[model samples]
Target: MTAKAKYQEVLDLGASLNIQNGDVKEENGTLKVWGTANTPYEKNLIWDKIKAIGGESPSDIMADIKVADNSVYHRHTVKSGETLGKIAIQYYGKASKYQDIFKANSDILKNPDVIHPDQELIIPNA
Candidate 1:
């Protein structure tokens, strides 16, 4: 199959994610995809789709996926028993940085001690 055809699923996945500045081209029998994802999780989703279709570490597709928000380290999907301090420690290595996380997600978070499961929080730059 042509490179573009081989990786059509990956391209479709990118579209579903609303990738910005997306470009798809076939070069030397390899599918080349370039785009900016809103978050690291979204970028990983694209890679997961590519690997699902092509196997682990597929050599047939070359994807350049950039995270749009470089200022933030990554996004955190809150789980049960997860607090801003706990999440902060996971990304910032210091539980004391919980205030930063609270400030970053102030739109949804009213208190640093209270966070609900499944809430997506932005882990801002330290």
Candidate 2:
């Protein structure tokens, strides 16, 4: 397959993420991609998709994904029936890390267990 075709999913994912300053080029069988992700978490998701498609060190594709925000790992919008512990597991793989999330969002979160839907919380880096 052509390099561009091989990495079509990566391009699609970048579009879905609304990556800024995105550029793509295919030269001499190498697919080159560049973009800025809003957060480290978003950048990681792009990298994970690339790796999943190209293997650990696939030489056919090259990507330069930059993170726009370094202050926090990600800004998470709370969903119904979701707890900080569950969100922590999704990002840090540990439920106990919920305390860290709670603390980071302490200005808005008066109680760790009293979170409601539609609240935006800062998910501190692990």
Candidate 3:
């Protein structure tokens, strides 16, 4: 399965567990369930089942990419066939933002037309 698919699957499972905000706690490099809510006993049961299955917390399932100022900037390594336009679309969800990316990494990307593999490009916030 694709990485995105796997991530979604894990998120779905976590949501299925019906873990409340209070139940999830980050402790000693792992997320553990601490307490039970009064209203939803069924959610606790689901959480128990999830724990039995060795399921991790939603945060544990997420990718550990660095975020700056509440925005995650993508560090894209240029591929042989990839263009700035493609990279912009991939990162910013729009090809028009190519100039934005170009402007951000002007030092590295001397020429917008010439990009090679392993050339790290900073995809700025859209």
Instruction: Give each model's whole-structure lDDT.
Output: 0.86, 0.94, 0.55
Q: Candidate 2: which pairs clash?
A: none
lDDT (tens digit, per residue) of candidate 1 on 1-126: 897888888888899989999998887888888999987767878888988989998888898999997777678899999888888778767999999989999999988888999999988876
- List, residue by residue over 1-126, the lDDT tens digit for candidate 3: 433343443335445644344234344444443332222323334454444444555443222212222232556778889999998877656888888888988998788878889998777755
Give the residue spans of candidate 1 off by over 4 A. 73-107, 110-126
Best by lDDT: 2
Please provide TM-scores, in order, for all candidate models, with all chains considered together. Answer: 0.60, 0.96, 0.47
The clash count for each model shown is 0, 0, 0
Q: On residues 12-109, what C-alpha lDDT tens digit does candidate 2 reach at each position?
A: 99999899999999999999999999999999989999999999999999899999998999999999999999999999989999999999999999
Q: How many angstroms is residue 92 displaced in model 2 relative to the true structure, after the best TM-score fit?
A: 1.1
Candidate 2, RMSD to the unseen true structure: 0.9
- Lowest lDDT sum, 10 consecutive residues, model 1, at 39-48
Error of 3 at 21 (Å): 18
Error of 3 at 55 (Å): 20
